[model samples]
Target chain A: MQVAKTVKDINNWVRHTKESGRSIGLVPTMGFLHEGHLSLVEAAKAENDLVVMSIFVNPAQFGPNEDFERYPRDFERDSQLAEKAGVDMIFAPSAEEMYPRESPITMGAGTLANVLCGKSRPGHFDGVLKVVTKLFHLVQPDSAYFGQKDAQQLAIVESLVQDFNFPLRICRVDTVREQDGLAKSSRNVYLSETERAEAPKLYQALQQGAAAAREGKDPVPEMARLIQSETSGTIDYIELLSYPDLNEAPDGQAILALAVQFQKARLIDNIIFTLKEN
Target chain B: MQVAKTVKDINNWVRHTKESGRSIGLVPTMGFLHEGHLSLVEAAKAENDLVVMSIFVNPAQFGPNEDFERYPRDFERDSQLAEKAGVDMIFAPSAEEMYPRESPITMGAGTLANVLCGKSRPGHFDGVLKVVTKLFHLVQPDSAYFGQKDAQQLAIVESLVQDFNFPLRICRVDTVREQDGLAKSSRNVYLSETERAEAPKLYQALQQGAAAAREGKDPVPEMARLIQSETSGTIDYIELLSYPDLNEAPDGQAILALAVQFQKARLIDNIIFTLKEN
Candidate 1:
């Protein structure tokens, strides 16, 4: 498998692939390979002639006080796992290489960013959009793969592609999960034994919320109540809003999402479903 | 030459061209076919296998009080002129087609946009960046052409491409001028008989400023005084700043730019040059 550590290297690979009439699928990620990231790569490989997985822990996407300093990175492990997962190439650029200078063009996430994760972490989606814009230009992939685990990010990215008319497709892969129903996440490592035990209940609460919504009932309060009773972690938020758009409409496709803040980690989970007709 | 009035049509042409391993050069313009725009077309034709010209009077780029409603457009004339100029295709979509819904992503021009024309016209560069982003995505050209006549816009665009690492080159085309040295612009039609005669002085003042800067002398005041003494139009602004970055530096390459608001039209002009070593 090819490993590209600079923009020029990745672009060279992209150009050669395009010249040979091969379609590329990009799976953009921060390093520390896990089941969730591997799932995206698997999805990308199935749909494209070449699968490129970008493994940069983007500094732009983290808040000043956020976990940017401690964000896990294991390049050797990641490369081995990516190669094993059938990734054709890995783009792992350094922070200096990725951001040579401050960008004069800044992208705003608009109203879609003012809720949920956006409310707690301002400028987070903007940073995500910025990096994604650069990656899209650098890779010029035929299609980009995004996991449903970061549903808000996926929605915002989809909006960017639609609004800007980027010449690519967005493929949404389902979230990888543990057998006990906890959403698979790199942050799952930060959970204590007690916190880990309680984490599964977060997803369980979301499942209960989904069932309630399926039965034509409002699910936010019920979901919150379940988490409050079961988990030791503090509830960050629990919301049931229109899927993708994230607006206050529950009749159509909706997402029942919640975030729980533990001693060392903040974990989030959601279930997207179409509400049954009343 | 093919004339595409829809995004899908343009994408089809782009995809077909890419499949055949042909490079595309884009010359984005707001129609009324002036000599300046034709010059960009000439530049694009010389560099790429296919030249795609986009004639879009982008509403996003215009202020509410600006000349959006009255922006000059002659599609029949433009199509004929473009065909004559050897344009391979023209992508001219309607405003509704370009902006189907309010975009959830907004682009900001950053510090580069807070001076010169940006000061007088807020959000103008933001709008330019927005439309340009969409165009760049739609065309996906190998190189995009821009006239140095809109020096600020060119600088901002160059910054965008550099900072974002867009996989394209920006070919700078020299400004097309009248026999009397006035910059050729579609807005030239709005000038009255006497104002038309006085217009060439704008370029003359810029030439004087360039000459002064070449001699290591301050040029802004001198350039402003020359315009004030010579032209009947109101002096909007006259300044000398670093080329491209548009910051207050005069040592390296610099630009002496000015704007004059005539009775019915606002005309702008500039000259870019490298300062001689002291």
Candidate 2:
């Protein structure tokens, strides 16, 4: 696979691909490619004539107190994995290559970013939107792939595309998970042995919540109780938000999402499903 | 020339142009066609195989106290003018068509938008950036045109394109002028005969200030004094700022800008020039 390290190279490559009448797909990720990121790449490969995967640990998306300096990165492993997944090109730009100066224009996520992780980590989604916007412009993909593990991010990005009239389709792949039901995340590597064992409870609670909501029970509180009782960690939030909008869910559709902090890692998961009317 | 009033139609037209291996240029205007806007169209026509001019009197760029409702618009006139200027298409989307729902995301103009027009009109540049961004996405032009009459707006947009890595070049056309050296603006029509006679003083002051700066004098205060003394209008501001950044001008390059209010019209003008070292 070809590897592009500069904006000029990637744009030139994309221009050539378009001139050849071939559709291009983009999969943007923070490198440390897991099964989840590979799943997005696989989706892109299936749909497009050329698949470009970008792996940049964006500093704009992290707060001062957050793990920006230590966010996981392994370009060699990522490039190999992306190639194995049939990616045509790997765009691995350094932070300096991506941002030569401070970004004088920033995007505000509006009401959608005011809840969930947005409340916990302020200015996070603004940064997310900023970098994603840059990636979309640089890649000029016909379609872009994103995992549903970051459901809020997915929703905000979808809103951004629609609101800004971005000329690309958002292909949302299902969340990749471990055999034990815990969602696959690069941060999962930071979990201790005992925390790893307790991590699956986060997803379990979401599933149980979905089940209760399907059975006509109020799933919000039940999900919170289940996580609090089952996990040996601090419960950050247990919210039943409306799918895609993140407001309080209406009767027939809801997303049961939660965040739990272990000794070494913080894990989050969600189950979005439709409910039958009572 | 083709007229596209919906996003889908304009995008389809743009797609067909690209498919035929032709480049597209865009000139975005707020209708009420004048020689100034057509000049931008002429520039676009000269540069690209196809040119798309959009006449959207964007409400987003107007403050509540500003003249949004009274913004001049004449699509028929604009289309005829655009055709005469050799434009390939005119995309004239209605406000409802442009914004079917409330925008879920808003752009912040950062520090460059915090001065001059931005200070006098809060949330104005945000709106300008928003609609400009929407137009860029919808048209996907190879190069977009803007008149330098709105110097601050042009600078903010240039910064937006760079900071977001927008996949297009910005072509800045010189400010079009009347025979009397007054800059052509849609609002120029609002001036009474006496006010029209005095309107040229704004440009004269800018020219005088530039001449003084060329002779190694700081032009900011002198420009303010000339406008206040010569104009039969209330002087709002006369400032010299750095080109493209709007900070304090350095030794060689500076932008002399002014805003003055007539009995029936609010007017703004600027001259950006470089001085030879004394």
Interface RMSD of 2: 0.9
Q: Give the alpha carbon lDDT tens digit for every residue of A95-160 in model 1.
A: 999999887779999998987898999999999999999999989999999989899999999999
Give the alpha carbon lDDT tens digit for every residue of B1-278 in model 2.
89999988988998888899999999999999889998998899899989999889898889888899988777777778888889888899999989988967889888887766777888899999999999999999999999999999999999989978899999999999999999999999899998898889889888988898888788778777776787789877787777888887555677888888898789999999987766
Backbone clashes in model 1, listed as residue pairs = none
Error of 1 at B127 (Å): 1.1
Candidate 1 ranges beyond 4 A from true positions: none
C-alpha lDDT of candidate 1 relative to the true structure: 0.91
**Clash totals in order:** 0, 0
**Given candidate 1, what's the lDDT at residue B94?**
96
The reply for model 2, stretches above 4 Å from the true place, is B276-278
TM-score of chain B of each: 0.98, 0.96
B86-202 per-residue lDDT for model 1 (tens digits) = 999999999998999998789999888877788788899999998998999999999999999999999999999998888899999999999999999989999999999999999
Per-residue error for A250 in candidate 2, Å, reads 2.5
Candidate 1 CAPRI category: high
C-alpha RMSD in Å of predicted model 1 compared with the true structure: 1.1
Assign candidate 2 its CAPRI class. high
Q: Please list the C-alpha lDDT of all candidates, in the order they appear.
A: 0.91, 0.87
TM for every model, in the order presented, reads 0.98, 0.98
